[model samples]
Target: MTEDNIAKHGKKGTFQISCFYVGEALCGIDIGFVQEINKQVLLTSVPHSPDYVVGIMNLRGKIVTIIDLGKKLGIESTANITDDTRIIIVNSKQEFIGFLVNKVTDVVVADRENVSPAPSNIKGVKGKFFQGVYKYKNKLVAILDVEEVLENE
Candidate 1:
C-alpha cells in the first residue's frame, strides 16, 4: 500500500469492511461507503447503457443504477441471480449506485497495517480497481476502489 493510502485507510487505526463475492473472488468495500444491502430486486434495463450496467431499480422512490460488480471488474458476470445474490447500495457523489454481487459475505474489522498492495492481477481484475488487499482467516479480500470502479470506462 502507498503511504497515502495507508494514512487514509490505516491511520484511523482500523475500519470496518463489508465483504462479498464477485464470482469466486472475494472482495470488500469500506463500510462507511455502503448505504444498504438489498435482495435481488427487479431491474429495468437501460437501452444502450454500458454493458456493465445491469439496469436501474426504484429503491424506495429513489432511482439506483445497478452494475454487475464482476463485469465492472473484468471478472465473471453475476449472470445467474440466486437467492444469495445481493445489491450493495453505496452513495457516490450524492447519488446512490448499486453493485450486484454474487453474494454478501461477512463484515470484517481489519487493521490498516494488514492491508497489502494488490497484485498486478487478481482473478483477472486489474489492480487499479483495488485500494489494497486485506487478509482474514486465510482469505484475501480485494478492497475495491469505489471511485475507480464507478469511473466511466
Candidate 2:
C-alpha cells in the first residue's frame, strides 16, 4: 500500500483503518479514503443501473451514488436497511461515492507489516477485491481495495 492510501499513525509503519461489517464477515478500508459515515438517507432509484447500485442520494447538495458493498463483494446482499445500516462515503477520482454497509465498527490501528496477503483459498473475482487481511481482536478484517471495488464491472 502507498503512503497516500493509508494514514500513518504515531509509529512509522502503522495506520488507522475504518472497520465495518458486511453480513457476518468483518471488513475494513483505509481511513484515508473515507470522507464520512452517513445514516440512511432517501435514495432516488436509478433506472437501467447495475443490480448492486442501490440508488442515488443528495448529500448536502452533492449527488452521491450509493452501492451495496456486500453485493459488490460477493457477500450476502444487503436487502434490509436497518438502523445499523450505514453509508461510507469516499472521495474517489474527484467524485463522491458511498458504500452501503451493514454496520459501522471501530477504527483499528494496524501495522503495515502485519497485513497478510489475501488468502489463497479466496480465489476468483472476490479475491481481487481484497487488499489483505489484518488480524484484529482475534478476528480477521478483510481490507478492501477501494479502486477495485469501485471499478465498473
Candidate 3:
C-alpha cells in the first residue's frame, strides 16, 4: 500500500452519538453533551426572538430555551404532538436548552473512518450544524452539533 492511502485510511476516531429522527431525517448528537430527555412538557413563547425559537420551558425549576428542531433544520413546524415527538434537554456552553424532535433512536458508536464529512453544498444553515455523516446499518445518519444549532438559532 502507498503512504498516501495509509495516511488517509489508517486511523479513525469514534464517539457515542445519540441518533434521533427530526421529521423524516435521521440525525445524531454527541451523548456526552446531552443531559436528559424530557417527555411532553409546557413551553412558554419568547417574544420577537426567531421563528425557530419555539419557546421556554421549566425543567426542575430551571428555565430552558426550547427550540423547534424541525424549524431549525428548515422543515415546517407543527403545534400538534405526535407519538414520535420528544424533548431532548442539553447543556451547551453551560447554557441549557431543549429541542423538539420526532423520535429517539439509539446510541451508536461512530468512527472517523466510517463517518464522511458533511456535504459542502446545502440549501440552508443546517450543514454547519452537522459534525459529519455516517451510515448505520444501511442508512445515512447525520451527527448534529447541538451547541451550534441552539447558539445559531
Best-matching candidate per lDDT: 1
Ranking by TM-score: 1, 2, 3
The residue pairs in collision within model 2 are none
Model 1 spans > 4 angstroms off:
8-10
* Tens-place lDDT digits, model 2, residues 1-153: 335334432233887889998888788998989999999657999999999999999988999999998788777787479999999999888899999999999999989878876764342337668777889999988888888888883
List model 1 lDDT by residue over 1-153, tens digit each: 678888765474788999999999999999989999999569999999999999999988999999999888888898579999999999988999999999998999988777888898998889989999999999999999898888883
Question: Local error of candidate 2 at 135, Å?
Answer: 0.4
- Number of the top candidate by TM-score? 1
Ranking by lDDT: 1, 2, 3
Local lDDT at 144 for model 2: 82
In candidate 3, what are the lDDT values of residues 24-130, reduced to their tens digit?
67888878778998776578888998887878988878999888888887865634468767888888888888888878889998766667777753334357777
Clashing pairs in 3: none
Residue 132 C-alpha lDDT in model 1 = 92
Provide the overall lDDT of each model, using Cα atoms, as 2-decimal numbers: 0.90, 0.82, 0.75
